[model samples]
Target: MMSWSHHLIITPILLPMATAALLLLIDERNRTTKALISLVSILLLAMNAVVLFRIESGPNDFENVYLLGNWAAPFGIVLVIDGLSALMLLLASLLAVASHVFALARWHAVGAHYHSLFQLLLVGVNGAFLTGDLFNLFVFFEVMLAASYGLLLHGTGTLRVKAGMHYIAVNLVAALFFLIGVSLIYGTAGTLNMADLALRMPQMEPDRLMLMEAGAGVLGVAFLIKVGMWPLCFWLPGAYSAASAPVAGMFAILSKVGIYVILRLTMLLFGSGPSAGFGADVLLFGGIATLVFGTIGVLASQALGRLAGYSVLVSSGTLLMVLGINDGIVSSGALLYLVSSTLTIGAFFMLIELVERGQDAGANVLAVTMEAYGDGEEHDMAEGEGVTMPGTMAILGVCFAACGILLSGLPPLSGFIAKFAMLSAMMGTGSIGTTPGAAVWTLIVLVIFSGIAALIAMTRAGIRTFWGSLEGTVPRVLVVEVVPVMFLLSLTLLLTIEAGPVMRYMDATIRTLANPAAYIDAVRNAVVIEGWGPGTGAKAGGSL
Candidate 1:
């Protein structure tokens, strides 16, 4: 029997799967029941995530891997948990909780099976994070994409439908690439188990090695598309901007799924051996280009929704660039940045709907145009012109400012700390790591410029929405809706307050990732309980 502690590895996937199934059976008319069930399930998953993080956060480097059907890795399926996956698990669950609560305000009822699809999306995300098998990674990828398809079209509108269609088409092609890539890997390595594949890489013949890299390159393309890489990401802004608030907020973490896979595979398989630096230049340059594009979009966007969407690209590009650098110290900061940016953006996405609720159609565009060409005449003061800002407007303004500060990497926030950590580490100002002159400096400039662009864009939008529109009617916001935004923003605030401990945790995660031996050995040495078969129902436990 597996230890109860070890069983925690599968709960993130299992809990959501069960919740989604249960939710499906519940009548959609009883949406309150469905919502409560889904929310409670996610909240429990959040608790599970906390426990898993604590389990992995200790001094020990030994990771937990639960072998399926009482069979070991390189043969049977396994769910593995280490510091990174635990962190990601926590991030995903917490984001889900916030988005779900936000949806309950009204968005859930507008769509059919919203709760079910949402839970299924969680299943796919957690499964992808946990699985050690490459084939299952593809399975989870499809599951995630599939659920996302329904969620993207949840509150269907013409713009949303069009965006959803494009999203589906793009991901379908990417899925094909994912299949081809995985098949090639299995064909050459004779295993779909990631650890086993990593172990096999050193012994592969040169021809087989070349083929494997080709496969990995193809695989990278699929994830890059998901990561919203330039040229491949044209569909992203539209889809993201078109989705309803809660779904869009949840979608904030979707790109990170691709980043996680790329990091896991790149570091495990290609981080060393014959292909140590094989595809670094491509990702490095590609990441830079992506930042450039995302920044341009940020500055050029007049609509708040589209700006938030482009901001996702900026986040993806930053992480990819850091990963391409391949330094553990820099990666630690990137991890922090990932958490901060995701939470900030999630809050921003939810907040955008609330802020825009009171604005006139084309107000964003008109606001931008008026700024550029100037409104011809000044308006005479009306009777209520000097009225103070409403309580709701004040709250929204504060949240908006918090988001702007976080996204811009401004001072005293988690975003600033995360960016500072990465930059200092990259520049060799930190305790470890060194940077090259031209290329790294170029990346450094782009990173800084992206932050500045975010600042400019966010500031302009803020002025338009809060300052200029202060006299406008306050949008009717429910406590349920705004609290979720506050919840996400507050977490970022907590991240700032606890930066040292979080980064220390991040350091441990990067260390574990650096030592691929730890992961490979954990899988290889995992044992089934003695005298215990798959269905024996023994009360014993296996060593992890």
Candidate 2:
């Protein structure tokens, strides 16, 4: 009997895959058919997310396991869903749907295969979130990367091709390292099942444990590269800034995948110190450095695209710092901040690109402003042609302000609430009291510095582009672009207003991640016990 749990894992993947395949079958010139297929896929994925959340709300942290071919435990392929996965899954689906809608307006402008590549990329992202095995994670990473190559270089322009090469090269290196690390881990542990590995990791010898730690460290570096943290992030701004609006929005979710994997691996395999362990320090200092570097980049950049890129870098840093703190309060705060930031930042980037596109700009302000002015005076240019309207600038201002509030930790925004949660958590440890501890001081400095830097940078960008007098005539913006920006801003505000409920839910989810025993037990119990199975397989309650 097929269960909802099974569907939960399969639906996010199948819906997108089926959509992409159906899109392929449609004539390349049939834009209407392609758009309809995209909408249906998104609706189905959203429905599946609702079902998964309902399941997760039930007792046992909403765990569901689907074992391939009736096989069980360490022997068979498994797809498991728990609290963290559920939250990420829902977020991915939401972003995917929103981005797809934003892309519809651009379909006529971009090539016909754009929709196909987009759906394929979705398949890879959804698969990454759903897969239970490490090797499968690598496979999905490649799938997403391959599709992204097409999307990033969709137009075959000189600048985009240059950026795409750098992007691909960096990722290819990361993938190689990832494969090596996974191979090493498998050779030493004899099991690739995440649950089984977690259970057995505590029993490994000290030297063997060191080897595992090294492997994990290498893997961590690879993911950090993907996340574009500090030294590893040089390729991001150029590559992302060069893509079209919809492509940039899709790319926003890409880096988060690396962070998601880090969150998963840290809590699952490394949090409890799986051998000779150094707890979260690796994440702490590295995170702080990333925050500083990203903030500096944001401050220094003259282009809107690069600024957005750097802000993403800062967001990644903040997330890592929260993870590094490792306290329940910190974890909950980090998770909330991540959810809030990802949506806002993703929306913000797309909005900027739309504004730029309307103005015939490419990340450079003076050039864009000139182009807008020139278009206004063109003899052949129609009154509304190649020009932005007043309503669009108003919409852009609102979106920019919302992004600024969320990214800069301002009040009445989820970013502020989430940062407060982290501060509260850090203070709970007496680190920031009358007697200041080193950890407390560190947290204090990090939060204050990061907040100030981000605020200044975002404020400058917002003021210059939105409020400042247009040195030249402004271009007319389209309705298709403004609607999505407003929608995403609304989501940020909603998260801020409902912080209490959101935090409570996030806390429950973080607690589950912090302690995986419940997750393991749930999956273990869900297995149907059939007397004895062949070749290393056993019933739910039996030994392998």
Candidate 3:
């Protein structure tokens, strides 16, 4: 008999796995039944996530740690639920529900196993968020990538197939790096459990310590690839643009999965250990470069789909830069920004499909004409040719404006609030040494400039689609599709309304993360099975 606390921690993973398996048994033609099941599973997962969050946030000294089969930590599988994991679980659930609902309008039928793959993807993502050990994290990472490969090619166009193949090849290489890194860490640290590794890191010999750092560096590279960090992110825009709308919406959370792992490991393994500040410089500078790259991509993008893809890069880069700063205060604000930006980008991806539907053919022709000749007047002729639908343009216009505000960190929305919080936190850090450092100045300048670029790109795109191109045929958007976009945007509004409580929660989470003792203690003290002891089970180089 398991307690509610134990059940809640695993529900996000188990429920999805079970649901996906069940969906696989159902016929593809039973679309109604499949949709209902997926919706129910997502709703239940969201409810469970809320419960887990409340329990973690409550006044309790004991951590919400669960050991599978009653096995103790550092010896067997463990799942730990802290404020950060709870927040991520909640965010993943919300995005999952919205994407699923939006897919029911059309995308679900575009592929054979969309519903099953969607649930499996959630299983992977939620598992990654909750797992407390390194090996399991790798397992979940593979699960996620496997499902994402299918989702990326769901619609099955030539462009999608090519992009999907590229995406798969890149991730396969990353996965190889992940395995090598994990193997090296296990060999060096003598344990696969994160908490146990943290405990042992301070006591290791200098040679082994160097080996551990090398392993961690390799691991960091693997995660950076997933996060779309610079030089390794060439596949992102093309892959994202090729994906169907709902699938692309879900992909927004996928990059954050990498960011989450970096934050978790940075705090757990290195925050106060001998390796403290190990990768901070690389993350800091690399993040700034990634931000600059993303902003340039955003400014130069001609298509809304590509712009949404670049926007994901910008969000990832922003969080990475902040995490690189390595201040608890700034991290608290970055966490808020994480939630706001993920939602906004997900909504933006969904909205892009509807906004671009009316001018797809014209845009393609213009691209070809421009490429064939130096310049062309095709775009002028294509503009204002769309047919006007009474309420369609108005609804899309409002949603597009909301996405713009959120992306650009404009006033009154959650994006502005999040960026303001981060800026204030950074300023509170005061000048680095005697004068302000170049990184600090760069961060400030980029934040402002990125917003301006996003504003210009979104505004230009919006005018072309809504105001400038009224002569084109009106996009036929289903109510189901439109509602999900509204729901996502409305949640951003709710975040704005509930800014006080949310920020306080994020602040508390950061404090907990900064002090790693609590996390280590919880894992070390987790309940043990009857037969297992510290030295009795799988140790380093032994079968796990």
Candidate number with greatest TM-score:
1
Candidate 2 displacement at residue 286 in angstroms? 1.1
What C-alpha lDDT values do all the predictions have? 0.89, 0.75, 0.87
Q: Model 3, stretches more than 4 Å misplaced?
A: 61-63, 364-389, 429-435, 529-544
> Candidate 2 at 151: error in angstroms?
1.6
lDDT of predicted model 2 = 0.75
lDDT of 1 by residue, 1-544 (tens): 4446767888998998999888888888998999889989999999999998887787543348887777767788988888889999999999999999999999999989999999999999999999999899999999999999999999857999999999999999999999999988888888999989899999999999999988889888999999998879999999999999999999999999999999998888888889897678877888898899999999999899999999999999999898888888899999999999999999999999999996787777777787889889877899866657889989999999999999999999999999999888878786874545788888888999999999999998898887776337789999999999999999999999999999999998898898889888878877666676653333322223
Off by over 4 Å in 2: 2-5, 58-63, 107-109, 273-279, 358-389, 429-436, 469-472, 526-544
Better of 2 and 3 by TM-score: 3
Who is ahead in TM-score, 1 or 2? 1
Q: What's the distance in Å from true for residue 445, model 2? A: 2.2
Cα RMSD of all models vs. native, in order, equals 2.1, 5.2, 4.6
Model 3 residue pairs with clashes: 384-469, 384-471, 385-471, 385-472, 386-471, 386-472, 386-473, 387-472, 387-473
Rank ordering of all candidates by TM-score, starting from the highest: 1, 3, 2
Global Cα lDDT for candidate 3 = 0.87
Segments in model 1 whose C-alpha atoms lie over 4 Å from true places: 60-63, 379-387, 433-435, 534-544
Winner on lDDT (1 vs 3): 1
What lDDT is obtained when candidate 1 is compared to the true structure?
Answer: 0.89
